[model samples]
Target: MSNQWQPHAAELAEGLSLIELSDGLGHLDLGDSEDVMVMGVCDDSRHAMPGYAMLCLPRSEGKATQFAESAKEQGAIAIISVGVSVDTDLPHLHLESIAEAGLLLRRMFKTEQASTHFYGITGTDGKTSVAWMLREALARYQSAPIWSSGTLGWMRSSNNICDIGNTTPSLLTMHAMLNAACQEGVHAVVSEISSHGIAQGRIAGLNFKTAIWTNMGHDHLQDHGGYEPYLATKAGFISDCAAHGGSVVANADHADIRERAPESTNWYGHGLDRDDVNLGWEQELPGLLRLSCAGEEVVIEDIPIGDFHAENVACVALTLMVSMGIELQALPELLTGITAPPGRMQDVAAGYGQVFIDYAHTPEALERCLKAARKLVRNRLIVVFGCGGERDREKRPQMGGIAAEFADAVWITSDNPRGELPAVIASEIEAGMAQPYRVELHLQLDREQAIAEAVEVLAEGDILVIAGKGHEAYMEVCGRRMPWSDAEVAERYLHRKHPGSGFDGERLCA
Candidate 1:
């Protein structure tokens, strides 16, 4: 067995023949035999398989054991774990970081096939909405395009969708997806860029033509360690776009984004009035918006409800104009017929009034949702919302304060309270309320029942805003996902009460 290593690559055994191999023990390399194929690389060894190379990273003993067990079933060729072992007869090499192996693979395959336009969007909120909306709009005018990596992660130009867990996939998967899209003659690729993805170098070496900056707020503090780190990660996306002389559309309304604007002729500012340039929503209506930009008015009617959605549409619209060269005058006509993204201020027809299911988990997003719900109705605005467990707990009570201020009736219910007591999370949120109001402290822990109860109590001319799990089709609890949908539950209850009404917003049961 021959042992050779590369310092720069941080990979073990450059080219060696595996004379002997074991699923539990490492590999023994002969002087020849360079045809070993690696099936997949994972940090957890439990997923390791037989007939494949298993690279177990140091400080990941659990992963190494997992790999050893799973590899036995899959018929793995060799197991490469962290640190050095001299007692074993198997050939072994040391590695500094397992992530380095993934990078090495991409470097060896460094070559471009075709010119692809990539649009990357990053922010605390609006990342998914902007990415999805841009892809949908671009399809109407351009040729068949392929977009991957966001909520669902992988969606082809053919609209074949699959679940890839990360907001930004691994470097290997991302490049592979991009390569596939290029081979299919895809015109563009739209993606949601997360802060963790940027910091971890997941998007390294990828060529992006356009980038959009949404407002930055307090979220993901645990991952980034602080607000400054979070902001820096987001700024990196714009910097990458600027390096290629690509257009970067920034939110002028966000002071942080405006302050961190990069130097590029393609850079365009979209905001409300500043230094003789004002770009934003002219008049925002319920599910409609009059978007004005660059002295042109594009009234986008029947859009997703929410005050902040108007701003999101503005960013997407301006991005189209600056990056794809879509005409501004033709935008209103184009966007007027667009459909709202799922779970984002989605209006569910109830028997008594309209019910809105939104993914407004943050304080700012909740505030915008409440304010928008207030305008769309004649009588009162009722909100049913709760914070998720094991997340940013500080925002719990703050959201409670917003509910107290904006909502006519507030129902604090469990929202994916994973591994945490529902009562504890509700108590934290209740601490922030300033005024006395009709608050239903339901520790039901069942989201469907909460929505059903809220719908049953709604009167005429009232709106029930179900905030938290917007487009998600399932509820996650105790590391397990359960089938659940707020919209489905509300619609089902509404239909049973009002026969033949059939999903209309105006029909009332009582």
Candidate 2:
């Protein structure tokens, strides 16, 4: 949870033998000196210390041997890896698969026995929004503090936020977070579960009290091997919750999800009957939201902007009604306090022109965001976005095409580009568009400069949307993470352009 870590496990105070450490999770035999005792467990070589059992994780890059060497030199008592020992000096243990280690990790951290309720939201979209909404609604309903972990990292409340390192962190890292959350008096936890996390068994022994599957679309196609695998991965988590006697809530609008969900799964979406959970907006944005549950409806005057928000609200409402024993009629008061997770269609002051920041990298999410943003303005719509490197390359062109189709002006720039050339990524995105000369299109690799130019060209009533890195504060280039923020950068330019006018999102300094 914290940036700095001193990895230690108190269960091994007197030290546990290597055989006992492995249990059924590890497979390695050292006939002699098999009783070597390990005081703690750590996977990071830099954090390894005397009497610690180190885990050798697979990496896309870097030498694995060097990591083991560093840990051994630091006095690691043994090494647990995905496969058989890899020429290591320390006593070694291996697993049949990476997921098997989840059991070992759960026992090591003791989170499997914790009473804190876990709620998971998985899918290509709406995970972050749904998780935060659940957290906010639960915090208002419960007496204990609520903690959530997702794209924006871990945060117990508005004033308390910490880095979680990933959308779904590693098994070890997640255990550490849950352990910390339990220690901090948190009785409920809401988190986003990614496909990679599910495939890798990050949620191993943590039985979710309820899980929601938002709609899914084109995303991480390569990582999951294809559409079916990706769907299966996401559905696998939902099914896991259902199989474990936990509640399951799915978006009925998504046919794939509706068809795949368990028979007992509770559904909520656009056009359901009054008997089921549903949402109806009497008016557009800044209008009344009619949330119906079991033929009962509540009218909320102020609502979050976006068509998807209705579904998100309905999903949360259904979860509370079915799983948490809160009546649908009581939701009107608690629902008012629900807040949107930051960086999703967030509005900021831009003087004459309005600027919105959203983390819409996929085609569907981007289109939805642009449509919502377009409704907010009377003039031209300008957009700035770029695809992340080393990810699903197929979505890059689709995103570019979506931007061209929706925006009057498009600024193509760099986003992350972990190991790929920024220019190459931009060119691929540009390839999706036709008849736009390289010069005719505004292509800028420097993200800040791209945002500056986009902000400068904003007209009196035009709305500028900086998509793909919403609340993200860092840009990963090569192997390093550099400081960056879409909203902060846009705000600075807006402030500079109109020094006298308060340029905060609300247009008021306070």
Candidate 3:
């Protein structure tokens, strides 16, 4: 972390009093004076600088006191922890709950009054897509600079980014990023709010400009203990947004979302029959999407094809217009500039047919992408996908059932079997496909081999859809992240089988 992000952190910390920070945490300060200034905030002792306050989260695994001692040795001025007590002479404070961390950190960073707007997106799918798409629109069209934090990383553009190795960053990291964005003159920040992030209090004390619900489905059930609880966690974020006066943009297509979203929501979806904005779109041609807002028809051309893509695009449009105050007349020029986040519905044209690589790990996402591929298929559509380990295990067979129902053939492969046997995960997936195979079913534990085998089966006018782990460059197996890329592997095998295949160099299309 190079002293945990250089002195930019120290710059935020400069002149911030430990007493004020303690009061923000609802703790009594033992500082010598209110002048006891903090130079930075850090969780890792390795990055502790002079006057830095070491923030120890509860998940630090009983090492908070040891880490605080080390940070004190490194010249840290203060310590903030939960339950753990530091023996050092530094001014130490405790948080009653982890949820207070975000508000306290925001106060410490002085970002509570920043002029920047925050748009938070959360749902089962399309979070990454909408986050990037909105950032693209705001960064290109709006005069003020924009940034997005999500699966692709914290980025202003495709090339310009800082990967902090998190989808929803921790409170310290999030406050630091927002502080940095404010320092950079950024006006809008688009962030994907995951279910884990919501439940874990990663975004506590955050006031959203708009809280967007893309759609919800069966994912992350294991973490929440059931689908009802998972839905509740997701819905609570949106409900909180409305309760706090933040604008809500909801996808009206999902009954779950529709039932949960507040009355003040501006909605978009193929199912919406609204008097304000009706966004039921049909593909006029391959890659052409026709969108309507408040009876004003506009066409968004040359985009990724699917109902899910349409849903994502519509969500972006609503956020732009309803929440962001963008005019309908500006829709065509603004919407056309947006692109799907990398590894989402990425396409490649081979000698036989097209090949698609997508981050469709959920059942709804997999079915949507496979159905989209079917639109481009003249003969057959085959899919290659798998679920992650240590996640919602119920979705394993559910995704398998979706694959069998949608694709003409299936290649079930390992995604990220972290600490779980890939073969065992595959067996659970296979249990979903109960009937004698309607088409051929290939179960290959080696993801690269599964992709290659799927590529070999492509025929003239046959589309190969590789789902799950779309833009990811590593496979997490047994707690180790091994280097891997589905796009690169598929491209290499596509070139081997069809010598004419090569990269389009834009979207990895070959």
What is each predicted model's overall lDDT from 0 to 1?
0.67, 0.77, 0.79
Task: Encode model 2's per-residue lDDT on 1-510: one tens digit a residue.
Answer: 443433332223356667765777757756456478777777677888888887766541255567778888988877777643356767878775666677676666666688777889898988999988888889889966898888877777866766666788766766766777777768788989999889877666677888888889989899989889999999999998999899888887778987799998887767535444343323334534676655656765555777766667777888887778887678878887466877887775534538888889888899989988777778888889999999989888888888888788899999989999999999999988766432236999999999999888877888899999887878999999998778878888887877777545333211
Candidate 3 per-residue lDDT over residues 1-510, each given as its tens digit: 231233223445366777767674657556564447877788778888887888877777568778988888988888888645555567877787776777777787788898888899999999998898888877767766688888777776677666766788776767777887778888889999999888877788778878999888988788888999999999999999989989999887789988988888887767333564435555656666777766677788766677677778778877888776787677778877467776787865443347888999988888888888877789888888888998888888888888888788898889999988888899899889869877679889888899888888788888888889888888998889988878778878877875644543223421
Which parts of model 2 have CA positions greater than 4 angstroms off?
1-31, 34-37, 57-66, 86-93, 272-284, 350-353, 434-441, 504-510
In model 1, state the lDDT of residue 301: 78
Error of 2 at 326 (Å): 1.2
Which ten contiguous residues of candidate 2 have the minimum total lDDT?
4-13
TM-score quality measure for candidate 2: 0.88
Question: Mind giving the per-residue lDDT tens digits that candidate 1 earns over 173-193?
Answer: 566555556656788888888
Off by over 4 Å in 3: 1-13, 23-25, 29-35, 82-88, 271-279, 348-353, 500-510
TM-scores, all models, native as reference? 0.81, 0.88, 0.92
Q: What is the lDDT of residue 25 in candidate 1?
A: 31
**Clash pairs for candidate 3:** none
lDDT (Cα, 0-100) at 226 in candidate 3: 96
Model 2 / residue 302 / CA error / Å = 3.1
Q: Report per-prediction Cα RMSD to one decimal.
A: 7.4, 3.7, 2.9
